[model samples]
Target: MESKKKIMSEKLPITEVNPINSRYYDYAHFTYPWHFHSQYEIIWVKESTGLCFAGDCIERFGPGTLIL
Candidate 1:
């Protein structure tokens, strides 16, 4: 129930000077909680293995996985 009530609204660091905001994350594990953003998100897994949750859809993802 916390995930349903505590959905975070993320404000991406995008500016007029830089339209697109890109970042590379190399972490031991995913620490971010359930969240949503106004802007579209594209996640590319270069090397990793985990589950991806989008709405009610849940699936396993591995290296070279691209989620749009």
Candidate 2:
């Protein structure tokens, strides 16, 4: 499947304002759309509970959860 290039926000918390575009999210659920990027992306679930879908794999994620 061909992935899409998402253009994240540039205003601080919306997206990484700095050069190395890595940002933090503090919310209740995983609501971001299922998309992909050329740059490596990492997700660290600090709180709450939800499911993560990657390709054909589906896993439950919660506090202390990290995905790359």
Candidate 3:
């Protein structure tokens, strides 16, 4: 049998409410590099318009966009 290791992010944020937490980020520009975490993330683009780079896919997202 073989096992695979998922890519971990060095920029993993420190959640005050570990196990579950949420917050809004307003940035003048996309500041995060392509990264992944051990947990799932639900992101809602409230403002600004730009492209999203996920694993093996590229997408355009804007206000009211929801990502899971």
**Which candidate tops TM-score?**
1
Model 3 spans with C-alpha error above 4 angstroms: 1-8, 11-17
TM-score of 2: 0.60
Candidate 3 has a TM-score of 0.65
All candidates' TM-scores? 0.77, 0.60, 0.65
Could you give candidate 2's per-residue lDDT for residues 1-68 as a string of tens digits?
Answer: 99886744333333355446665676566666556554555778788887787656799988899887
How far residue 2's Cα lies from its native spot in candidate 2, in Å, is 23
Worst 10 residues of 2 by lDDT: 7-16
Give Cα distance to truth, residue 10, candidate 2, Å: 14
Model 2, runs deviating above 4 Å: 1-19
Candidate achieving higher TM-score, 1 or 3: 1
Q: Residue 10 lDDT in model 3?
A: 50
TM-score of 1: 0.77
lDDT of 1 by residue, 1-68 (tens): 35445889999988888779988888888887889987878989888898999767899999999987
Q: Give per-residue CA lDDT, model 3, range 1-68, as digits (tens).
A: 89875555754565767667667777888776556866677888888888887767789999899877
Give lDDT: candidate 3, residue 35: 65
Select the stronger candidate by TM-score from 1 and 2.
1
